[model samples]
Target: MDDTDQIVLSVDGLQVLIDVLTADGYRVIGPTVREKAIVYDDVASVADLPRGWTDEQDGGRYRLVRRDDSALFGFAVGASSWKQFLHRPVVKLWRARRSKNSWQVVPEVPPVERLAFIGVRACELEAIKLQDQVLLEGEHPDSHYQARRDNVFVVAVNCAVAGGTCFCVSMSTGPKAESGYDLALTEISDGEEGTVFVAEAGSGRGRSLLAKLPHRPASAADRQSAKAVSERTAASMGREMRSDDLHELLHRNLDHPHWDAVAQRCLTCGNCTMVCPTCFCTTVEDASDLTGKEASRTRRWDSCFTIDFSYLHGGSVRTSGGARYRQWLTHKLATWFDQFGTSGCVGCGRCITWCPVGIDITAEVEAIRDSEAD
Candidate 1:
């Protein structure tokens, strides 16, 4: 059989797989209930997963609820994406200390952790690839990001339930994982068999790990069930965007009245950027000791919504909320194609769900198209 062939793993065997990964010195990180929400955290067993629980998300709303059965990956994504581990919110770049006659410099090197990420969604996988293009394929590739990314393993989850704000189906980035995973799983629950994972190996490492697990060759029925899960999610999506000529549409509507309308409700809190899986903007900060003997440079996540983000020689370029909002939206939906050859958004819908004022990006795009039609 081909190495990429599908297999079926019982729910109990899933724990054994986790045990094997942890035994191999991989820090397994997956979804867990935290602060009344399902967020990624350290996992050693099935108990760490959001079992028998799911989430309800909408524009500016999120709540955890009990599921009918114990399905490990029944819920859609939460505010936290895997980018937190790979890109990091804050990192020290280097340090310098004053010497007797000259300055002594010490470069800060980030420690690489052997990480195995569980429950990675399809859209998030695409986001990871986008970040690789941004941080690993650029003129000045980020050694720090590359080190962590290289040491990481991905266990992707195909969605069975689409969040109220999710639009990954529209973006062609989710509801099903196509590639970029060591192993991909589609959770299936049956009255007789209870819950089982239909798994597929995407890499040589995945096949090697599966060989060690208690998994059997998947049957035709299991494959059909897995396909049904993705179909249900695609049909149940609460939001969607029309992507036809989307880049050109946004490029032409730079001064659209809709931007001003949304800007009035926007708080510019940077929550959207914080939750977005693909937003990669960052700022560098330098700090010195009170004695001015020691100093360090640090890189921290930044957002375009901030006034200082667009600061130039004279002052902040995007001083108005409308201008900043325009810059962010245009860059994400339009100019990002020019810069990266793909849209900055993966349609995970974190931006819409976490927006303070329930601002839906798909709705905004539709409004622009409607106005142009009129």
Candidate 2:
């Protein structure tokens, strides 16, 4: 919001800029050409990006296909989420080393990595904000998550093309970035002459990076084009959420019979929650050495779909699949606002597209709403 000034960089030039950031002691992470989807990974240059690559996705299906356009990052997210970087899949808390007669326990602190995450979507940015509340701002803070999050710089990218599964528009979390990013970029590939990116700085660090890049003064036309691109993405969303007041709708429909019907189709495979960028449930484990002299503790991601997630002193609270699924959906769309002051969903549609049975959250919500209407 400081100024409209921006530097235009060609696709190749953008890669060079990342190299420069790396040379200057910043670890650069961006979307790269993976086996089939555009995945976030370490990249040293532009060639590391998924150039001329796109994806075709449907319920429980996704495939990488070639595109005629020479556009990098023309696809949606891969299986990996920002959660892998911020909240690690697995972490060791302590290690047990043996002395002559007794064992000594050593605490393992998380290594803070100065990371620059490039090409983060607006929805993912919001997801990070949600996690920030849980991991950093919560009552009991996670020292490990705090270290990684504090040392990180975010480079957000506006979606140029909406995936078949994307519904960020209805969620109101994306199509364009609002905040929580150091830099935001709108990739312009539909121009008459060449490719260019319109960059905006969200912080002083971002402004400094822009100052070092080879860029030109942005014109009013560039700003207009960026706006148009975001508008198109909003219009092209594959799914739509009808409940403008999502919280009220979710609470009202809790007892709706539709929950039972959907539970039949749901495998409870936990794929939806696992791939979700904002789902932050976790469980801890303890291990001991063979001699029983040393013990270590580890933490890993957990899902509500799992029966043990709700387990407490007596027994599992959510015993049935329907109950657990309902808990997850209600918490994500309804109660999450009260808990985190934001909707748990980014509307990336990953849950719908990645579910083993292709269970569409939007369709389910509509069904419940329609039943109530009748």
- Top-TM-score candidate index: 1
* TM-score for predicted model 2 compared with the true structure: 0.94
Instruction: Name the weakest run of 10 consecutive residues (lDDT summed) in model 1.
Output: 1-10
lDDT of 1 by residue, 1-374 (tens): 25339999998888998898899999999999899998899998898888888889999999899988878788898999999999999989999999988899999888979999999999999999999999999899998899899998899989989999999888889879888999999999754688899998899999899889998888898898898999999999989997768899988988888988988999999999999998899999999999999999999999999988989998998988888888888787889999989888888989999998998899988989999999
Give the total clashing residue pairs for model 1. Answer: 0
CA displacement after TM-score superposition, residue 364 of candidate 1 (Å)? 0.8
Error of 1 at 31 (Å): 0.1
- The per-prediction tally of clashing pairs is 0, 0
Best lDDT goes to which candidate?
1
TM-score each candidate. 0.98, 0.94
Instruction: Give the CA lDDT, 0 to 100, for residue 261 in model 2.
Output: 90
